[model samples]
Target: MAAARSATLSHLISTNEPPSLFEVAQLRRCVQTLVPRARLLWAEYKGLEERLQLCRIVLSPTRRLPAEILIEIFSWADKKTLLSISLVCRSWNASFNVVSSKSLSTTTMRFISEDGIPCHKILSWLAKPVTGTKTLNIEHEVSYREIRCKCFKPANPCPWAAPDFLNLLAKNPTPAQMVLRLKFSSPNCLSRLVGGAGNSLLWNSLETLHLQLTGNWSGRASIYRNALDGLPKTLRNLRLKINNPKDRRQPPPIEVPEAPFNTLKSLGIECSWDSPLILSILRLCVDLDVLIVDESIGRHTWTESAAQVTLPKVHTLRVKCLYLHESEKIFPLLHLPALASLTIDGGEVPFADRNWVLARSLRPLGLLSPMPRICLRTLVVQSINGLDGDALWDIFSHLRFLRCLVLQRVPFEGAGFLENYRRRTEGGEHLLPALRMFELRDLDEKFDATSFLCFVKVHRHATTRRHEGGHERIQEDAPDGLRHISLRYGDCKESRKFEAVREELVSMVGALERDFGVVVQMTRG
Candidate 1:
């Protein structure tokens, strides 16, 4: 047997013939087995090099500088640079602390690692007392384990229920504003963090709160019910956003607060809410000065007995998404007596639905009613489809006090709107006489630039002649002229036509700017 093995080894060592496939496979397997070990060695080598570089930095003569000089250098550095340099050595960390302690007005706490590991260091640091922090932002993003374990489905509590953080918040001077963003893993998680049972005085002095709640919260409206139970009276501005999950489960309704949030002056909602919840919230905001509704105003149905909500003090109202199917129910529910600025953004419409005019949906209710004559000063309408010439005239003729007008993606018929406007101005009518600024953006292929320029010339000529005799010829209520005019349109069909008439448009706009002192900004694709 020994002689056979020797013969085999000698043949394998000195054979001229190519090896079999089995031998090739064995060799590949051996190479694969060493890959991880090689990686480990490379990592160790890199670590050693880093440590040697750190040693060199420590032994350099720069380390011998006085603490006062170091403190001055640290003071000049920004927050990110100071943090990076603090990791070099203990003395640098000490210097950074000295600078940070004096100028730390904002503190942000991120309590979890990205890949699902618990940040034990941050958890331990949360136990220390923090003072003089005017703004505190705490955010916990979704973790890998939470995704892999499907923790959003089960009622399992997240591990980072830091009671110590709540205690620290209570110990410090009350922050003027606090922003909290977290996922609702379980009710207990929020109960221990900021709920009523967490700390009684946590929000006593807070004036502004921006709360963003996100999760697969299809059947968990109770989470919001418990979370918003104990708001501070000093909160004057509240921005709430709930990122809705893609599901069809109609979550159970949450109860509205018995008492109103009378101190809230500005409210912005960025998500869809049930009708009852939205109505309740608006009813409480009596002093709301600015209101922004980014998403749908209401998601569910409303009964016949649902009363209209009156926001008497809302001066600036922005309705970002106006679905034609739902606009009828939405517009009649609000009565804003003091509305001054309005933005109606009708987001992209399908090709098949090009004839749905907004005039049909804008009923004579709320601020659109003509009897009392809403003193709307600024009007912005964008991305609207099927707004014909007559409907456009109907909407614009009522705004006698409009100072700024912006229209985009409005495909009016031929030159109808502009012709009517010019004839009215020439006939000594007072429609939009107070207009000071007009902006047109992203016009469709149906736009008639020649007609528009004619209107502009007529309007400018009329207004410039108002003070020709060194005295005001027009009414005192009307403005002198249009101070600013911006025309921008870009699309496939319009781009071709724009190139054909680009030079003429530029020359005309320049003359308007030079003669009337009007700021004309014109661009075409």
Candidate 2:
């Protein structure tokens, strides 16, 4: 055996033969003789090289992008793709946080024609707050768990109990803003949140608090009042809307949350203008800066408390109603000296003349006096009966700095503002002395074209201001020069019928362009 191995070792006859255990034992002993520290260093070097190569192949260039850029890139991605990217890692999860983070704004929602949806399921799901979410909007149609309402079945009253809301509030106490709009099938509804139970995080730190109730509001007035009072007092904006389908014959007592609405800066209420709730809120929200009233005057007889309410800081007031009679009543209470923008619209209300209200209520306020306190810039008025010319004059006389004027569905009566300006010229004072943009709409064949022409001529001249310091120095915004006059005639057929009148209007427009360098347009309303 020794002689045969000797021959194999020398490769004298080693074809188809394997090495013996003695050869393997010698190789093992050689490896065992290496230095321990050298082996460890070699192992580490190989491991690190492998890791670097793996990183080179798998690491994404997108990972090096800044978070803001990454977010923008992800924003353009589809929803499913965005979700997939979010699950990549914790940092990426945070980078593309869309609905999951503070970028989500407070929104309003409404669901119409919805049948039996499990209110508890929805409330429970919403109550499980989306982390870092800012506002939760439950627009409409919430119901109880396991209970279905077939809206098609008239026999099923689908009366949802109040306890479901309690369960939702109990489970998911909101830490951010939540817009709650409730419409109940019956007179009964959830009364209030649990008296003293909530997350440590205050819910009132929200940017806005909106509550709208549209069912049998009268029957559940106390319930709503309790809910509102129990709400947090840290809201910055509040919008309350109530719609009652029942006749105004037996109006219920107005109920709103008792305040120290200390943080509320903006308030919009769509209840009756004479609602006690509105008065109560006004008395509480002293720091309000924006107020919009879109309500009709109810049967509220002014009591002693009504005289004390005042909104001191409101600058923008927009009144939208079908009737101006309520506005007439509202104007007396709103002695807003700081008012800058006023919009009043009598939308589809018969016998609603907003100009009459303005003339009646504003005249005594020393409005448009030689030295006026209110510096109004924008005025928008709309009505059906057409504004009385004297009424328009009375309102315009009070405005010296008015820049934009929009009149809708209101015709010019008597002598126009320019005609009045021409007659009552005392030291270069023109009608709407600083007017820039004049927009009128929905004038029928009965509209006075001559009055409109006069309006354009006067406003174009007034738009160019002269300075005593320089020779013919125009105003800073003189380039516009009353070029933004837009008029819409309600009846295109009428304009076609009165071809001569249409040509006359076109001639006037052409004259404006040629002489004053102003562009005027007429369109069908």
lDDT of 2: 0.59
Error of 1 at 212 (Å): 3.4
Write out the backbone clash pairs for model 2: 119-143, 368-398, 386-411
- Looking at model 2, residue 78 earns an lDDT score of 75
Q: For candidate 2, write residues 297-403 as lDDT tens digits.
A: 44455443456456678788777665445443445565677777877666655564444555543443345567776777788877645565565666686676777
State the RMSD for candidate 1. Answer: 17.1
**Residue 468 lDDT (model 1):** 62
Error of 1 at 367 (Å): 4.9
Q: lDDT for each of the candidates?
A: 0.63, 0.59
